[model samples]
Target chain A: MKPHWLVRPGSIRLLWIVFLCILALTVLAGLLVHPHAAFGIDGSFGFYTWFGFASCIALIIVAKLLALLLKRKDTYYDGD
Target chain B: MTAISLIPPGLPLVLGALLLPLCTARLRALLVLGLPLLVLALVWQLPAGAVLSIDFLGHELAPLSDSKLARLFATVFAIMAFAGGLFGLNHMRVAELSAAMISAGSAIGIAFAGDLVTLLVFWEALALASTLLVWSTRTPQSRDAGLRYLVLHLFGGVLLLAGIIGQVAATGSVAFTAMALDSPAQWLILAGFLINAGAPPLSAWLPDAYPEASPGGMVALSAFTTKAAVFVLLTGFPGADILIAFGLYMVFYGIVYALLENDMRRILAYSIINQVGFMIVGIGIGTEMALNGAAAHAFTHIIYKALLLMSAGSVLYMTGKRKCTDLGGLFQSMPLTAICGIIGALAISSFPLTSGFISKSMISQSAADQHLTFVWFMLVAASAGVFLHAGIKFPWFVFFQKDSGLRPPDPPLNMRLGMILFAFLCIALGAWPAPLYNLLPYPVDYAPYTYAHVISMLQLLLFSGLAFFIMLPYLKRTLTITLDWDWFYRRLLPRAACPLVRALDAWQRRCSIDTLRHISHFLGALFLYHGPQGVLARTWATGSMVLWVVILLGIYLLAYYF
Candidate 1:
């Protein structure tokens, strides 16, 4: 069989590092280059970087609250 | 070529659907493949600005007309039918296939219809046919959902009808053209179209009912109804400011609900609302570029959304499981399915070099150029939310999370072929979008791929992925479902109805027993006293009359003598 190099323990750690590096590089690169600003705010360095992160967390918090009000048992309608 | 007058482009598919049950299985398959192709050819050959009118019920009905916009919608719709047909070749119920084809045909019908009368005809037919598709699954859940689907669509159909009647009364024409939303009738028309576009308060119907379809049926269901609404809204009520609010609500509602959702298909269903929300916002912006964005997004959305549904359906078909709670780690066995599903996810998130990247950016660009700062910011936030919820959540939970120890192979050959075809189209369009751009109603001037655009898009999406991993624990799958507007109908309405029905029953009982008894007693007494055999009714009355006459005669004599 071909070596399961992707699943090896060291390889997994290496993969995680690579992923983090890529994320950091994208953020760093975003600071270097200006996006043709859509709004005045979007042109700021790392606007997408921070906004995307914060909005996702904000969305999750809101969804969590909504879950309290709206969430029901999986079989809520069917009554099984 | 001969003038194709009487044969409306959609009729062949509708008629073919009616004939499907009569055909042997092989013949049925061939017809499904053939009908959409024929419609596509006819759609292309028909000249722009050609209108065919038929006299029906003393009103001229333009059942077939052509425009770049109509042709674009019709082309994508026909292509959708073909893909859905190919996917469903080996494993679909006869009834499902027939209903799906009929639904597809009617969508195409609406696309080509030049008059409100013809459009309404096709519109109502679409609701009925699609409801049949829902029920074709024949499951108890599907049956219940199908009934609700039918009711909601019929309600929308009535609104459209009332609006059409009012418009015809007010304007004295049936032409389906753009109108300012100044009158009540026009607002009603917008309301009707909005309801079908999965606007809030009625938006729950889409996620509730669509996931209940059979795997193949869901793929078809994802394509037609909402997109058709977008088409009509684009034509009828472009740049209506209220749509911006409605569209943003849908965009966020989809993300929040999808975030809370566990059923894989339901997640995708909610994302449909989310994606269509973008198109609606584009229409609301109402610039030439934005309208082009709306139309182009609709075209690309059909392909990618169907592809996403196809992947989810394949998982359901292979494993007989739908909830993320019951799914994971199938990438080991189903690499092709996983890859295609991931591609669909990336496209939906508008990652660079995807069809969504090409189509969706124009809407935001238009918003920015117009200096609508708040709209642009919200749209940007919503795009990030999309990547977080759909782009990462979908693939992460289904394929790569902790192994659920179930290893199902990829779907059958035809299903794979269908998914592959759409997957290819997604990338092909993303890499080169000119074909789709040319099909837009307006002229092409916007370039999707630029240094700033690609970099920002990647920054948004990749960071959203980072956020997902950080919040991994919060996004855990659960055995729960999120309630929405449908709860009013499913839970509250029924609960409210029970007390009402009991009160009415008690009131009827009291009226029947006590009130009826009193009326009967009064009538009986009157009958007895006034009978012919009674004393006052006979001799006594005659004696009294004679005595009075005698007294009157005596008085008259006395007066004369005096």
Candidate 2:
């Protein structure tokens, strides 16, 4: 059997590079864009930004926790 | 508030659903198909702003009303009901169809409602109707999913009712009117509307429950609940700021989850959230253009989403499989369904020549004019994302993936015909959006097919396509389930209940044992005391009887003296 791709040396290096590039680009774009244009003026605040980010994180965590308990076998609904 | 009721003359359509199950199967099918057309005719003839009010529990209910907005939504709803009934007639259980018709009628009732009370009543009827659709699948998973779906919607309905009561108390007005979200009551009402829009935290419920429903049931389910919420939001809380943030989250949330999903139907369900996200954002912006965009998007989205679901349902019906892993190369045999599905995909992605392109662009244009740069950029990114996951991923995996060796023929002619009609509308609306725009609550000036906009969108989507293909290895299907908020009740609550149940069982066992011991001790004491010739037992029955009679006689003597 072929080895898992992620564990391969070249694949790992490529993954990291891609991750870093995406992160750098996102930050650079945010800095370059006018803050008002990037975020709406009416409701944009440091609080909301943090709140939005935190809410997303919380949702992911909650979903993961729920999956542990509620997930059934793939055939849970299937007829034989 | 004017007392002119907007209730339609076709109120009996609701009652007719109850009579459907009693008819023979063939007649029942005809009734299901024909009733909506009849109602549509009646709705067409009704005078605008016509009122049909009645008293119930001391509150007046205006279950029907006619306004431009109400008429537009109601007309489409009636059309959807007819199409849905036609599509469902072949495969849906008779009882399920009856339930769906009642649900559809209630949604129409909601669209025509002139008062909060009436809207709420119809709102809850929608929930019940939708839940029955989920339950009709007759699987344990569907049963559980249906129960969870009911709970969320009921919670939303309760929130709405509370908000309405608060509004009534504050303003002494039950008329449904657009208001700023200032007071707790108004805010509650907004929350209620947001929940139905599949807003964040609670948003996962839409994706969770919908894909589990019966094939045709899902098509019916997709058109009603969220759109009703959109109707309420557009009417009641147009300028709310919180909605923008919620909408943005939903837009990306849909793309992300859909990207990860393996099931064709679930991917479409997630995409529904994404598409509705655009409308929700429009509602939040509350400009004439934005509101018009929201309204128009609702109309087009309903058609395309239903069409997409129908196409997916056709596949599921023919092959009895839903996962992309199990489906591939179906286009060879199911060419008609595949073509219809691709048209829906293009429309959803807002390709220049599709319904989505015409309707969704107006809101983005509204944002651009407002100088809200971030909102504009995000919307653009979401548009690209829409193409990435749904536009390409859906048709690609289902129709073009390495052949899975299944060549199920196209679904029945009726299903194909329904899809073709919807597909034609999708293209026609894109080509000439005037008719749809004319129907909007506001005038439309935006053109969707500018050279710059079209080219940029194509570039963005094309690059995203490249990315999808490049990273196809990461997009493998897995057997593991992706959890959503329903996990709280489906997993967490049940798991939490298990330990509680065990503890209660142990406590009950100990209590029973203790009670048994105590009773045995009491009996032993009595038997020991009552043993042959022992103490009180040795005293004769005659002596006891004489003592009792003496006591009675003494009481009688005292009474006589008094």
Candidate 3:
């Protein structure tokens, strides 16, 4: 049986392209819609776009660092 | 406050729990579907203000209060029970279903409780019933996890009880009113509520036990306990200030641990703590807006969180697999489940048009309104991170990632129906917030959908999604778990006990054996000297006794002369 079109390699690349377009469109939206921030710096251009991206990157990095000490086999407690 | 006789909304569910096991499957299904709707109707029928008052301990205690906050909480709990009953109608054991009703019923009881003592009693009942729900799974893992859950809750209960005693002694009243953090009793009360809220140093219990429950059992487990804690905190000690710190920690802690989690269910479990943290923070803020946000968030959260769990539960129900490593590409077989799961995910992420969008923003909007710049920043980051972790990661791993060569269809009819009901609710509340807004404890003045608010939220969440794809390599789950606070008790305490137990065993043996030997040796010498056959005991002892008496008489005379 043929694989589902959603999962096939060619469609996968197209999905990525679509996702990127949406990402760009959100940033471009900053021109028409300015996010009113209570804080002074938060209202600057594309603040949420960059902040959201940076926040996730930071979360992943910090989580990875902590994983060094905290990570154990999923069966970590089964021994007890 | 009127004194008209009204049966409490939750009482029938508790009674129904007993009746369920005695009936046929068809009858049981009817009661499960009918009882919670009955409770929901009864809940709304309650008029605002103190409705049922009683004399207790030389004070007027309102055992039933239909305050707006109480009614709001009671309404959600009833919905949770109804949906959960539907979800579990087929898959869950009779014991689990019965226990779930008891748990849900008591949660309703707490919501309507008017005095501190009444709330505490209902809380304890909630704890015991919840423990029974976990134990009903009858797995070794769930049994031990249930024991840990019970111990922690009992510990929390003790703190609450002591707090109530001290409070009563200090104030001479039991009204469950808002308290300032001016007394040790208030602090104890806060600790008790926070512990159940999955606060720090004791937070590990939620993720440790909840995921261990059977699939449907977990859906029921997710709705109460912590949400009830939020209900109490909203009413009992709003604006405590310190909760802000605890809440922030939980939000980040949940995100990071979930990032590292492999088991699909534990990720959801950790996210429960993460989600409740937002409500706690709002309670700390304690503006009318903030409190409304917290209460509203709790209301919406129960629906979406349960929806997420229902979809996840469906996957587990069909596949009999829970680990991320063991699941993937199930969207092929379970399209409806996947779509419903995505809807739940979107709602939980607080995307532009969902129940979460309207409710969660109120908390952040309150923070921003107060110019709590730091809190506002953290909440924004956490909101984005919520999208990163739960909104994307849960569905991404369970349904859409690399194919694992397993094909399982969607769950049974009841489970599908359950998911659809909550899914509809998520969109309905988001699209039309007036019904939920109207039920808020405070008058609703805030509008959630502004062009600016919607735009910022979209950028934040969409970028978070982009980051997820970019960080895919790092976010790939390993076959591992992150260590948490429960390690102190579940692992460390038990491990630490081995040597102490051994030492105590040795000490007990010495007390019974070696110490007894020493006492027996002394007794043996005394017996040897005093025996009837010994020299002093013989007939000659009479002569010796007389000689000693004469000597004593002589010594006494000499002393007198001196």
TM values, all candidates = 0.92, 0.81, 0.95
- Decreasing lDDT order of the candidates: 3, 1, 2
* CA deviation > 4 Å runs, candidate 1: A1-11, A31-34, B504-562
- Which candidate, 2 or 3, would have the higher lDDT against the true structure? 3
lDDT of 3 by residue, A1-80 (tens): 99999899999999999999988887787778755669987899889998999999999999999999989887878888
Flag the better candidate by TM-score, 2 or 3: 3
For candidate 1, lDDT tens digit of each residue in B1-562?
Answer: 5466447889999999999989998899899999999999989988668889988767777998888999999999999999999998777788889989998999999998989999999999999988988887789998999999999999999999999889988998888999899888888888888888999889988988899998899999999999999999999988988888888899899999999999999999999999999999999999999899989989989999898889989999999999999998878889889999998999999988889999999998888888888888888889999998889899888887877888899999989999999999999999999999999998999998877788788888888888888899999989999988898999899889989989998888878878878787886786576657654455567678899799999999889999
Off by over 4 Å in 2: A1-80, B1-10, B502-562
Query: Residues B227-322, candidate 3, lDDT per residue (tens digit)?
Result: 999999999989889988989999999999889999898899989999999999999998999999999999999999999999999999899899
**What's model 3's lDDT at B331?**
96
**Residues B293-323, model 2: lDDT tens digits:** 9999999999899889989999999999999
Question: Top DockQ: which candidate number?
Answer: 3
lDDT of each: 0.89, 0.79, 0.91
Q: What is the DockQ score of candidate 3, to 2 decimals?
A: 0.84
lDDT of 3 at B376: 94
Instruction: For model 3, name the residue pairs that clash.
Output: none
1 or 2: which has the higher TM-score?
1
